[model samples]
Target: KTTTTSHPASISSTTRGLSAPTASHTRPTGPTGPSEPDPGPGSPFFFLWASPDNPYESESTTTSPPGMVVDNRIFEVLLSLPIWLMVYFCHSNVLDLYRKMPKSHKWAFPWLIHLAMGLAAVVSIVFGYARTHHIAPQDVTGNAFVGLNIISNSERIGLLIFAVVALGKIPETIRSLRSLVGRIAMEVMDIESIMDTTEILEVIASPMLLASATIIALTIRDLAKITDLLGSSSGVLLSLVLPGLVYAAIYSTPYLDIKDHDKRWNGHRLGGFSIATFGVGLGTIGFLATVFSW
Candidate 1:
């Protein structure tokens, strides 16, 4: 009998009806290890590089109508509003930076910074829309192939630059986050008397605990869903609701001798109350939508 051999790609195509380089494709044996197929969602090592299925996609089936698609998109945008507001207005780093700036530098510098930030955000949105305008939302899930196929080299470079800028901010961001956390802890625990102890714990324990929790969260399969849930709920409260309430309370307070500001039912007071009311409705709907959709 004549010996016969088949190419791996041909064998896989014929036998499994799948193309080569799929998750089913086995690694070539090397000195380091035995041959194994690529790690998939079910693999023990999947968490390391796994991009979970789109939670929104799973909320609707492939047969969903155009109306349902529109509805889903609306809900997504609504939920995202809170997160965008959070980042733009009430982000810990931004607030911290504003607090540290001198009175002279505050007005002009902040206005310029915000102008640049707003322009950058608008440009990013436009760029993303231009690139992925042709792709269906359903088709744009977090799969690696989707990103690789859609993002051209120029777009990739832009993304890399943005990533670098983000990375550069990490140190300042960490300090801001730590300070915020310490302040919150102090307020909640009423630890004013034990200030030195609180400071020690905040310095020593907080980072380690936060890092550990972050690592644990990364290992979760549905991290995106959790993130959305958080963004819709706590993010809304912090960014929109609290700011509005605090503003109104400060202005409307009868006892406090707030200088250079009127403590009356003025436009500022009305605006603050309006924002708080809007936030209440937005947060409730967003949170409900996220939970129900998930």
Candidate 2:
């Protein structure tokens, strides 16, 4: 008998019949990742980025009403806007840069101040975006992407500038705050309460709170910026460990009592503003932390 061989067309038709359907025709019954999670109480940032239901994930089945979505960016904006205000307010607290410069140079300094603030606001915006989006550190580096190096380095340099300025401002900021406390206390609370040691004990807690807030904000911001460039080990340790310890020191120390300011540096009053200054610095750092996050 003559050998009967299937035609190429027939073989191809059989293979097609056995093969899977086209991608366009297929539908996925389940998500590639986990299913939608339950809702929780907290700021949108905590709920969206760090929730027990599902930290770092959102889904269609969320408690959020249908046809409505809260962009966690609102929380990011809330977190960062305060930092802009802090930068503006902190300008007055710097180590008297204008005095060292000539009186003739006064007008020009305002421009520099504006430039610094503007740059800081922009950087804060950038960090806010990165934190909200959960950007991987490695992605921000390398030559494959244009302008990233410049942007990253600029962030780092800006941080250095602010860090130096913030450190120098601590003393004066403390003094100014100490001076303002009595006025604020007088305006809001009774003058008797302002002067009371018992009331002052309650008041003294404010500085540590300031330090804690500062530690949370600045440490996180600095860690976020440097972690990718330098790796997370040192940054993480410094960010988490130092803040607690510093705050503890503030808590443990007896000098956090609200006190008067003295202009001269060489008396029992040298550190008069020290506690308040630390508080102001903490507030600044905390605000900066919001600009970026871990």
Which candidate gets the maximum lDDT versus the true structure? 1
Q: What TM-score would candidate 2 get against the native?
A: 0.26
Model 1 global lDDT (CA atoms, 0 to 1): 0.39
Alpha carbon deviation, residue 148, candidate 2 (Å): 23
Tens-digit per-residue lDDT, 94-114, candidate 2: 323443665466446435434
lDDT of 1 by residue, 33-115 (tens): 44433211111112112323321132221222234222235324433543454455445455445446665664463244335
How displaced is residue 10 in candidate 1, in Å? 45
TM-score of each: 0.34, 0.26
Error of 2 at 2 (Å): 58
